[model samples]
Target: MSNADTILVTGGLGYIGSHVVLELMEEGHSVVVFDNGSNASRDVIDSVSRLAAGKGRVDLFEGDITEPAQMDKVFQEYSAISTVIHCAGLKSVAESEREPDLYRAVNVTGTSHLLSAMERAGVKHFIFSSSATVYGNSAILPMLETAPLSPQSQYGKNKVEIEKNLHAWQKKNGGIVVVLRYFNPIGAHKSGLLGDRPKKEAANLLPAILETVSGKRPELTIYGGYNTPDGTGIRDYIHVVDLARGHLQALKYEPDNDGVYIFNLGLGKGYSTQQVVDAFIQETGLTIKQRRGQRREGDVDACYADNTRALQQLNWKPEYQLNDMLSHAWLSHKSSLM
Candidate 1:
């Protein structure tokens, strides 16, 4: 298979998906972005196009992956989309608990719907946007891809279910499937053009912290009481751009490589929530008022990654440091407001 397949990115305007679109364009891959326009906008199309600068072709379609007819239309129009990066899903843990049915419908059933569309379209290569949340409240430190399949939250359960379903689908149909169990994806494209935002508001950590810096909120709240030394949860946060590049790597994965390839996308080191806040303050010389609170349910004390598999298998390594993540994320936050 050629590396230049016209790749279709579901939720293409989303934070991680947009960054991957830019990377694909930079690498001269023909790209098509399919979005529901729920969590993102047409503005991202312009940003990605500008980044591409005629290096490649980019086409956009306002659609949702959950709808088979909509995805079928996308497939019909873009028959050249031989590969897909599935990123469309409901992602909030709290929201998932409130509406497990929705999460299941979107993340699991919706994904199954997408896989069916792919099979019909004869698109054999797939990359799924999974989360480390699948590990969920584990006793393990620095999780490996081989970690247990016990997820605690509804959101995480959704990811785990879809991963299992994908494994089953791969076994039956046979294709190149890559499951990327991503840790916390912070930062943004180094160009400051993309950042995370849901259809409604921000719930992720770095975005919440940045919002506080913008004075959109009064203060940052650190959920404390975890078993970690800082009394807050620790996570391995990878730069969004680095995580995005991993998708491109998966796309370039050898066609002969059959079966499911799983990799944990992270920095292989953990940082507490407090540490992230302090890093932000240090990076920008900004004072952030933060208070500790009780640990939320389904919380883990520390969860990093054992990313040796990704490095050795994908021939890719995370390049940005904590400082780079802090600064670049802040810049992207500012850019989003502008």
Candidate 2:
């Protein structure tokens, strides 16, 4: 695709999607951000604008993917759009367990609506925001793209269902479809202008740690008694910025044949919860109150990634290390307090 191509980013105001939008704009592509004003701040665009610095054009649209008419209207309005980076979805695993049907409607049925709209608009390129949760709590140490999918949570199930639909959709309609199975995305933009919204209750690890250090939470619970070296669950944490760049690489990738292309976005290593907490304290010299809690049911001992395919195929590699991720995240979280 040329730099002139208009790229539509669903959930573009979101944490990860906002970073992807910044990356695309910095690369000089016109961006049309479609979001429903759910779980996002409109002021995020101001930060994106400051970072983009007139590299490309950006337009924001308020619409829900679950609404077919809204999806169709965006496609029809932006008739010149050639590709889509879908990042909108309800992502809380605990919440999904409570509302499985809600997850299905937004993550599954909503994606179907978007696909139909794309079909009508004649758009052929798509980049989906998938998660490593699709692999479930496998005993496998490092997960690969071809691993058997056994999603345990409703969120993971939603991603697996979407992947299956994308495969079938590609076979029948013929399109360049890329599925990115993200392991664990953490961190924020270097400028501290963009990051996860400061919430008293955070679902992810990094945010929880940041919140505790910033005194938002009383103490960070370190779920323990896992079958790992540190007795804590280990995960593959990739910087959000790195994950955003991976999408840009996906946009440039050309498939060898007519099938869905899937890749894992991760740091290709594991870090225990205790290790992450220690890293945060060491990197930022901040105190994080902590407590020990029993491991959550269905929790895996270790989960990382086998990023060889992403490295060899997309020519993509992560630049930040664990320290960089922690430092940048702290900077962003600290800036939010000001």
Q: Candidate 1, which segments miss by more than 4 Å at Cα?
A: 1-4, 255-257
**215-310 per-residue lDDT for model 1 (tens digits):** 988988899998888788999999999999888888777846589999999999999999999898999999998888788766677889999999
lDDT of 2 by residue, 238-315 (tens): 999999999999999987775789999999999998999999899988878899999875466788999999999999
Please estimate how well model 2 matches the true structure, expressed as its whole-model Cα lDDT.
Answer: 0.89
Model 1 residue 121 CA deviation in Å: 0.9
Clashes of each: 0, 0
* Candidate 2 error regions (>4 Å): 1-4, 198-200
TM-score, each model? 0.96, 0.96
Question: Evaluated with lDDT, which candidate comes out highest?
Answer: 2
Tell how far residue 209 is off in model 1, in angstroms: 0.6
Single out the weakest 10-residue window by summed lDDT for candidate 1.
1-10
